[model samples]
Target: MNDNFENLFENSEYSKTIKKGQLIEASVIEITDDHAVLNAGLKSESFVGLNQFKNPGGEIEIEVGDSVKVVIEEIENGDGTTRLSRQKAKNETTWSNIIRAMNEDEIIEGHIQTRVKGGFTVLIDQINAFLPGSLVDVRPVRDTQYLEGTVSEFKIIKAERKTNNIVVSRKGALQGDSLENKSEIISKLTEGQIIEGIVKNLTDYGAFIDLGGLDGLLHITDIAWKKIKHPSEILSMADKVKVKIISIDREKFRVSLGLKQLDEDPWKKIISNYEIGNKIDCMISNITDYGLFVEIEEGIEGLVHVSEINWTNSNPNPYKIANIGDQVTVMILDIDNEKRRVSLGIKQCKDNPWDSFANNNNIGDKITGKIKSITDFGIFVELDGEIDGLIHISDISWNNEDNIDLSQYKKSDEIESSILAIEAKRQRISLGIKQLNKDVFMEFNQSNSKGSIVKGIISEVDEKNALVLIENEIKGILNISEVSRDKVEDMRTVFKQNDEIEAKIIGSDKKNRTLKLSIKAKEEKEEREAIDSYKADEKESISKTSLGELLKSKFKKD
Candidate 1:
């Protein structure tokens, strides 16, 4: 009874010594899927959650008889059992290490677990630490999702043991590491050292590759000989790639890498493979508003400008001309090796319609086509061979040159026209609808000569002259002074509109393409012709009478 009382008193003393939240070492006595029983010199074994005994991969890491540190959350609750937490014990130790790191300015390893408000929560030695957005990297990073679940080094910037608050800066750690190894990495790098690296970050202009101790830039242009707008097109974060060191700027600590430098430059063989004016078949790879990019070969593309897509139409739509992946024939207009550019022409591969039309047709030849478009200035007619001919308003009719009625001509109206001009070099075809019929002026000129009398109706009368519509389609002007060789004050008084008048074509005025007619000259010419005819008849009668008298005398003498 005496030994039992002593044992109870010793047990009470041990229980008093075991305070709540005190981290203590314990040995695992039994372990199951849900709980682990640990003995920590207590009245009863404490049960620990089996989940806390698991490693990061979720496998149970502790077994029976293994010593593990645990924290006592409750020494004695309503029941007789003691509650213990394995994770809390680990966190306490980790917090102490974090505080030491902050005081000593030391770097530690961490795993970015998830994104939280204003920053991320990083797991450092089983304790959650705050990582601000600004301190995630040495430079600002818009996308930090790639860092999730990734292990990185960080420096403890702030730590509070009472509140269990810890803050870390990955940028500080990264900057320190870079400065320590930058000189060593730069020393070994040569002008053309081929090395392997991981794609650390991507930007529009290039990608930064992690070369063990430093970051090297792989420009978009050096990614491939062909064009790429962004580095993300070919590379992703953490992708391993082999590149050649193109250049090194040790003063600025910048390294330039090139992926294409490993391969032979295809442009070096361009002279043997291609030349200017060389016709070849290609596939359209891309289409833009300005032009189409055609793939000549691997890593080589040539631009076919909109102007070079067709022969007749200037500034044709690239989408209408061809689509992506369409096979087309193009002529190599130029090959600039120095610039690594090629000027290709789609129109040069086909026959020029202007040259073809000029060779097949001539001026004054009648052409039949449907009017494609009608405007006030002209009519664009769709002629043979998909060519277009323009009939200006002035060439639409014979007499309505000044005032034209566009309502008469409609789109898709079939009409017959004569080719007035064909400028092959300019790729212009001038058509005339009026030229298909006989010209009124030419008809009058061919039928009548100078001084010929012609009859016409006065269509318009003014003080200066009377406008006569000769032959319905031809117009002539008769001035007031030439009306009757008399002083004519007003032409309207002498010649009324719609009145029949006879006039002589005294001369031609080619400036206005009109004939100068005179009524006085016509009347005078008629009088002179009548007098001359009378005199000729009288002479013939007198000669006949003289001959008869001489013959009668001769007959009487005989």
Candidate 2:
């Protein structure tokens, strides 16, 4: 019984030699290549790293047989040796110091090693801590690259032993500075005061002005006397600007400032210097659809409407009359000091051409002019002044083969035209050089009667009728009735404009300027009847079919 008891006691004593995570006082017994054997007052010596022999300062403080507290990291494994950690025990003491510093709310000095996504990692003693970028400085920093390798003071905002995380805020320290700066700024700040300040930050709508210690909002609207598109247009980061304090909120420490108020208003002094009907020279600033905006003085602009540009022209383009940067003299038609607007006129600065034209011309005076334009029914001629006269096609001739060729006349063509009529109230004049010549019908009246046969060219052909121009002042109309006694197909295929043909004048009225001529009627009676029958059949065929069916038939043939 005694031997069995001794055997159990021996086994129990062997088992009590060492265990994992056991705190023990140990002595450095021997040093090897990478590890050291420490005597922990047990039967087995524990193995520790060689690096544990030296302090963080690179000094080997522990000597052989020197005692130190150690933590058992592992028990014997396959190699049969106990693992020990001296540094782990020393870390416990460091943690205690950190906790004490945190509780006391003390500022810790640390070196920032590397940057992470949101912040930089700082080495505080033997621990890794996070220093957020927002808390890095007194103001927000755009680039955090300069923080690497920099040593800074921070207050521990969060620390946890289990998680091994410590969050330090340099912003809290910066906030202290901001408060001090703010106090300094407010000491000298007041409403209705102007001072210089640095632009700290720019927002989409405005900028925050740093007036030494406090930040005041400088709205984009207040930054310029004129309209601005964005806050960045006038203010940029760190820009020094003169600002006027418009208001202050003592409770919230809010400040309102204006930048444009420093400049003098030009409108206030502009009206006193100028008056209506005064002619002033100015440069065309901008041309718009409605008018032209001209700058008459510095910061003072006026409008010259399209109607005011030229009295004689209608629907005149502002671009044609006034180009950008063109120097022009204008008369001030009206001015409204309260509305800050000046009405200007370009034509008022010059003489009215129409007024002078009306005074010089009358309805009956015969004058020579040049042909300006020719239309289907009349010829327009430019008279002695800027006036234009129209001679109707009816007045061009009194008989066939005596009609004038107006197409031979062109714009600015020099010719002799008679002044047939004029209306000054309506600002119109009637001129006819053709009428001044001997009347063709009266000259031929004695020889050719109402049934006279004449030869002329087909000067104009239309869907309705054809016109024959003969003598220099005579024209005859061949109506659709004359083109065909009954019906006719496409006129394009039969006769084109300017074709010459012979036609008998069936009737004439000299006073009313009317003439009747015919071509198909001059054909044989049988041929005319056959053509009329064919035309009637073609018209009936077209009327019977829908347009879509006709087009489909045509497309199919193609």
Candidate 3:
């Protein structure tokens, strides 16, 4: 009995030695409504709140005889019960685990609870840890509200047990994972390798793609076979796309991706698909000041220049004739495989007006039309089929003395003309109004000949010559040398307009329609006739009288 009493005193001494803030391993002995009795190697039984042994969902987490870690808050109280806490013990263990994770470079899982001034409060095993805004992700997070209630792994970068300060980074953990993924991707990457990626960002020149954890570039030109103004036209942010690796630079860590490479190059079979002078229907994809871009097929386009829009209309504006998304017929004017250029013509698909007019008519064929426009040099007549023929100013009238007033002939005036020439290549048609009637110069040549005496009135008197009108229609000229058989200084002084005169034609050119008249020839002919008359009268008188009587009569008269 004495040995038992000595052991009891030893147990009491041990309970007195138990101090506050001490972590001790204990086993749950009994459970009640409000308290859990625990055996912690102390003389007296310790009690912990039953709430500490329950999970957040109000279920019992610890049963009887279950091992638990706790802190001694009091050794001996007035009620002779040892006070203990389970939360303090859990906090101490969490700090120890965090320090070990930091030393081992391990990642810890945490839930973002709330936002703070410069960072977010994350609950790591019931202990609050700081997550800076800059380190939330690999990229900047514009909205932190999305992170609430999200559980993510993080790396403990800063830890101070005394101050209870801990800082964690989600970006650091992501970068660590990226390094491992990047190495594997780089080793396996090769040209012409097909892969899938997400569109991360966009720029003017290209788009950045996230291939797993690696970033690659998809240039604007490589997005599609056709032209694109920006990357957003073909792709949007966070869109999943399949691409082909066109090139790779390991030293610079750059990868060039292409979406068009997976499909066939349209230019490879362009020559076989199209040919010169072949007609085909196309859709207008784009319009510019110089031309229209026509789509022959998907990713295949041809240029229809402004010059090729029509045959008759020069300087055709593309905007006035067609707009975007219009269907039109075109003929392939040219094809260049090396340059990947196809020249198309909208006019070639239609019948050429000049060729049609030339084939139906011949020179000197008379046709009637209305004057469409008038210029200083000529008038444009619109004939059948909307074709225009030009009548030059010189061909408008037959009389050289009269100048036709073009202003008198207004637009839409009906006029008759004869086709003179047709230039199919130049798309020009020449018409003459004078050709509708017989040529007056031809008739003049048939009636008059050289050295013929003609009488007419002077129509024009100049220093060089005196123009005379014969038959009131034909014109003749009297040179200065032929004016009255004298050396005249000026023909105008000797003759005036409308003066009636008789002259002999000295020269005539039927082809050139020129008549040369001389007054000197007429005067010389009259003199010769008078001399012949006098000789005849003298001869008759001599025959009637004798030589002696004739001489005596002549001497008496003298």
TM-score of 3: 0.60
Clash tally for model 2: 17
lDDT of 2 by residue, 302-382 (tens): 999888887556468887766899999999998887777889999888766555655776655666677778887878877
Model 2 off-target regions past 4 Å?
Answer: 1-136, 139-192, 199-238, 245-260, 312-325, 377-406, 418-558
How many clashes show up in model 3? 0
TM-score of each: 0.63, 0.43, 0.60
Ranking by lDDT: 1, 3, 2
lDDT of 3 at 169: 79
In model 3, state the lDDT of residue 302.
94
Model 1 C-alpha lDDT per residue in residues 1-558, reported as the tens digit of each score: 256754684578766777998989999999877999998877677888899988887889998999999999987677867799999998888887886665444689998999999999999978889999988998999999999999999977667667677888899688875554778888999988999998765656788787875778899999988787888878986799999999999976789999988888777666778989899999998999999999898778999999898887779888876889999999999988788899999888888888999999999999889989988698999987788999998888776566668888878989899999999898889999888787777778878889899989998898999888888467788988788877888887766889999999988765466788899999999999999999999999999999999999999999
lDDT of 2: 0.74
Q: What digit string (tens of lDDT, one per residue) describes model 3 on residues 207-325? A: 77777656788999899888778988999867999999999987656689999899999887676777788899989999999999999878888999998998788678899999899
